[model samples]
Target: MPRKPTNIIYSANEKPPAGTVLILGVQHATLALLFIVYPLVAAAEAGLSFDDTQLFITSCIIFMGIATLLECLPRPGAGMLLVQIPNMAHMPLAVQSLAAGGPALYAGMSLVAAISQLTLSRFMRALRAVFPPEVCGVAVTMLGVALADPALRRVFGISGAITPDLDLRYALVSSVTLVIIVGLAIFSRGMLRLFAVAIGAAIGWILAAYLGVAPEPNASFATLPYIDIPHLGWPGVSFFSWALIPAAIITGVLSAVDMVGTVVSMQRMDDADWRRADLDQAGRAIQANCLGDIGTAITGGFASASSSAAVGVAFATGTTAWRVGAVSGILIILAAFSPRLIGVLTIIPSPVIGAILIYAAAFLTVAGMELILSRRLSDRRIFTVGLAILTGLAVAILPGLVGLTPEWAQPILESPLSISTAVAIVLNLVFRIGIRQEASREVTTADNPFTVATEFLEYQGDLWGARRDVISMAIPVVAEGVEMLLDTGVAPGKLEVRAHFDEENFDVALLYEGEPITIPDHRPSPEDLLGDAHAVARFVGYMLSKRADRLVLGTDGTREKLTLRFEH
Candidate 1:
């Protein structure tokens, strides 16, 4: 059962009121700046020239705008509000390619990866069933967990010779800025909450300017060329740098978690009729995202993925208007014409950007955990999610582990996201035997947990050709037991309902980690209906005895298990 969504001022596919569009669009544009930081940092580490870095940034900015427009548009995209940019999953590969060959090698590798991802559009529907919310959640969390350190570096303002020292002032500015963003988002009820990042960043920039860590307002932007063209020659691929092929393939596959995870978040925010992953819509979104990046091959640009910063802005602003996507694209394209804007974006206080990245990463990581935990944490899911996350984090953080890998394999293995996603998917299939056998699941709403239970039974019914009428009859009495269970204020992720079949009977069990309580045969008193939780449980037990064939109460260590058997 899904809880009715609250305070939904705008949905992912719907347009906000026209009056609010431009403002939301501006916030979105500001958020899009967060995408450039990854590539810029990668370029610095690769020791790219100032000119090559400029071209790289310019290409990515324009491509991000293009991808976003395609996604926001209905013709070929999922028509959801999305912000697209180069994915960080490929940053290590990009750096490797750049160092091994040059911009051409990087560009060529990116082009291949982007195309491979686009091809996934055709199979995303079938693949969606394989990569359920549980697997995707595990991969997404592991990806963010790997990024936490880079975000910390940003907070410290130490990238290279430019800002080599870890400034204490950077910490102060970022901390205060983070407080402002979180505090306003928590306490404010107005539109100000939506602009918390912009507000906090601006305030932090002012503070940072005083501490000599940020640039003061100046007209240096005026000197930027109004109409500059970027034409850095693409590097040539050589036999010596064949390492790029494998890197491209690896990133192309794993980067999809970013696209799918972002769309899932939007769907959650939309509170739509079917919040489950709509594979068709997601495929279109993926294609649109990929189409925007094909230009990088010719123009030496970074490939794109959905932008977390833009999504964060949407949650903060309480708007997911497609218009924001459209207008933000317009702004990004427009921003390209003003060299000053690019300069400004390139020089925004590093710590502020770091704060934004940390918050985005935190949100993504928590969202992944919530997605996985929203279901029954059966042993299969536990091992799949836990092993994948832990193993991925180890590969990402532990240097010695990566060093043990073969030289050519190090690039792909170095990316925790790629490895984690592969592990989660494989483990999901391996564990399906046990998971399908248990047929256990969890729901979020008390209003209709029974509906969920009944639906699940019907599906499990098909496996044995169990009669629909028999399943229908069990629904009413089953509904009562679940209603009572939900009324107990069970903690989230604690309730587990299991449905299975044996011979000629269908069986279901409600399991939770708690003490086994007594269920009374008689109706509970008025006091029981008011504040007494046990009274409701007792009443539910009474009802179950009459409705179910046999109600059994049992305990397995810390868990109290209630089994409801229906024999037709």
Candidate 2:
């Protein structure tokens, strides 16, 4: 079923008021700070100096703003209003690279990764057959699962902290923060709801300060320089890492999934007429994202990503204005020079960031599941999705158990996410999966309409045991209907054919994005369709009038659906 359309206060393409843009920009900036956990934690684990950490994180923030700006600006392939931040998915990989080879190793490897991802995006349209929504959904769900433990651990100050204990004070701060965020998001009206995360962080910060959280920022806030920029050097590749190329390629694919999901989610949120994804736009967005990563590496930050947090902020605020993100990017760039502001920003406790992560993880997990369920859930889908998610979770909790995999493969298998995504894709190919899935088919312009329509009806027609003459008759009618539709200037790829059968009713529905098409009660005369002296075309016109028991054209507010019912 199609989702009922709702009015959007600020769409992706449209610009809201300057005040509205400013409001959303600040909100988005707050959402972005959560991702700082990536570089900061990775830096700490790698034992980098305060100066090295600042330079690295500053690079991330600066390039993040640059990436966000490119993503927002009007371009042939890029969508508007997209927000880019430090991607948490790449945190582990980054930490590994940074710890092993310092910022240089991380930067060089990140450039290669982005290039690989850019290559993938160019060919994304071709690979849709292999990685359909079901496969992608499993991959996406696994990502959320793989990321959960780290976030949940931080909620109690277990990860990246001085006290890795279940201290009640930490728990209270995190829980209260989570409660406030969830409360405002669910119950509050207007802008208050949009700013929930920021508000929750403020409350959590104040609470943590009062309780004297152990990991306080050591940088003296009052005496911090009014403005400062760290001296930076160019990144050089270190031979400290193994499997750099394969790691870049495989992880790049995972990033592609993240890119596609973010684009689709934003489209669904903003566009009333979103039936099919704009693959070109998605590919372009990936290109922009790739540029961000490369820029981050060259400039000094770790690789960047399109954060689920940004998407959540867009959805929550009902503001998908590109200017908002662009302005936010500007603010981010300006902050890189402000030492006092950086110290204050860093002071937000880990638990608060953890609470934010919890919300994003939950949102992304549910969104992935919804994408799969939106179409149909087959037994294979259930198994594939379940297996992938469970495998990821298991690996996260028990990495030692996966130690049997060869050392060479460990780079890919070390994380449940990488393992599960690889597993799902392989299983999907082996099963020709979408197994036991619904009989719906996507309409693509690459195939001839007449051939597609004939095969579609005949395949379903045979199972129903419809008379050969009836099956034969119905095929041409469908072909003619489709050809006629094509001639009317409707893009072939925008149309879909979905067939459903019951004990008594055999229904073939044509779903397309266009003005509603009317199938008239009167049959077309042979002369009318015999243009160019085509016999088949003439016959089709005559048969189309009498084939189906009922032909009804209706609108789903966004697209027109034509249902053809044949009496069995």
Candidate 3:
């Protein structure tokens, strides 16, 4: 049975508490720095001039602040009023798209993409039933699995299977950095763990400097000479780039899905009631993505997504106050005014950032696996889901296995997000439908009552002791059992026990007031025969007739404790 809701006092008006703001602010700054490093490096490698790189970084900061601010302080119907984070899933795809189209095309494609997402908002709710926890779990796990190789490449500077001569010096520095980070996380308490990634990166930067592998950090604040308006360019409408449309759509949708899941999970963890308005509020938070993407496109940067870091910061620092978002925006605006600082940030070594990325990606993978396992799927369902995930991963990691020509399928297969989404959807549908006939056949002749009785008995012996109060146990019992207990005058505090055959254990409990009581033991002697359900029902009926406040059955501590309550 579901647990009752508890009241919690939350100050939704004004800004979040001061403590939350600080914690969330720090977290936001850390993740913003970490996630932006990749794009900066990729843009630099693509032969963007230093000036362009600075502009890009400046735009990123501004957009991050804008998106974060809007999410925290929603504008009527426009914002989701939730914490948002940078979108990591779209990075590889955006980078590839940028590489193919250059700055102008990249901007145009991004603009179109943002518009598409906004247009699709109306249909977003319709997708909920199709992407249940089970399906989402598989897709999310596949996402993590697919990104594993890219993470390794960034860490080690490997190209495909071709490994470069080991940069032993760089490797050693990264190793030491990771060690310090892991150690701190394990040994340090509270806030220290939260900042471990940032701390590790700082240490790695220093080490790189000592090794003479890092360039001198830029400290000036020069404005870019060229600030062109984002003029619309031709969209990448070729078959190759057009295939990317599905990938883009999947990214947007899955991101929304992830945000929803996060909100739901946080509410459950906090033991708060989930209002319908909260769902709509979450959707509005995603609107910031559209706005952020527009700004990113205009400034020749990749589109942005909602920031989970913001949520973490909010929770940790109790900064639910709206002013913190304003503070973050102010800081970002200050960053934009300083070109040299942005320049310095753009030069951080890939391996240093890559080390952190690798760890975080691995963590994501583990979390995905946990999500899958939490479904408690049957073995057959497991096999189907596992097969789908593996197939999707193979398509992503080993495209050659599919034997498709890159020229023809490269665009579609380019992103793991798209490939995995397709695979999961198709396989999930097949499995769900394929098993229907078998399920129907089994259901026709299945003895559901016997199965339920057997399960109850087994649970009683294995999980519930004979001396256990049935009323307390009944609290966690299924709905049917709960109704049955209620019908028996098992009020809040009374206890009753029902015993099955010796081979089967039975236990139940009913909540009385806020407390629960244990019922007396019910043990059958060797000579005494146990009655069937009809007889058990009669005994319970008689007990209810007597208005007994407490009833107990079964042996003590040996399982099979059944208790019922009659009063508050």
Candidate 1 pairs with clashing backbones:
104-235, 194-316, 194-317, 520-538
Q: Can you write out model 3's per-residue Cα lDDT over 407-472, one digit (the tens) per residue?
A: 435444555545665566665566555332111011111234234434543344232112223323
Model 2's lDDT to the true fold? 0.69
lDDT of 2 by residue, 1-568 (tens): 2332453556766767787778778877766755676778788888888878877888888888788878777673375666776776566667768777788888877877788889988896777555656665665566566558767876877745445346878778889988998888777777777577778888998898899883665747778887987455476765456666566666677777767767776766676644345667788889988888887887667667776667665655566777888888787777778767767766678788777777767766776676565434445556766787777777887778768876546667777757777777776666553333236666665667778877776666543323344555566666666665555544345577787654245566777776544444456565655444233333443455466777766765677777677654
How do the predictions measure up, each by TM-score? Answer: 0.73, 0.73, 0.62
lDDT of every predicted structure (CA atoms):
0.72, 0.69, 0.50
- Cα lDDT of model 1 by residue, 1-568, tens digit: 2332554566665666665777777767766865677788789989999888888887888878888888887778777778776677778877888887888788778777877787887897668557766776776576467667767877887665445455789888889888888877667866777678779889988988888988554776667776666444455433345667777876777666667767777766666333246677778888888787776656787777887666666666666767778887787767767676777776788788778777767767886786675444556667888888887888866857888887667766777766777788888777766335447777555447667867776666543334455577667766666666666754234477777764346677887765576767666676776656666677668778778887888875677878888774
Worst 10 residues of 1 by lDDT: 230-239
Model 2 stretches astray by more than 4 angstroms: 1-8, 47-51, 89-102, 160-165, 219-222, 237-242, 271-274, 433-568
Off by over 4 Å in 3: 1-27, 34-60, 73-105, 157-161, 216-282, 298-301, 306-330, 399-412, 434-450, 453-568
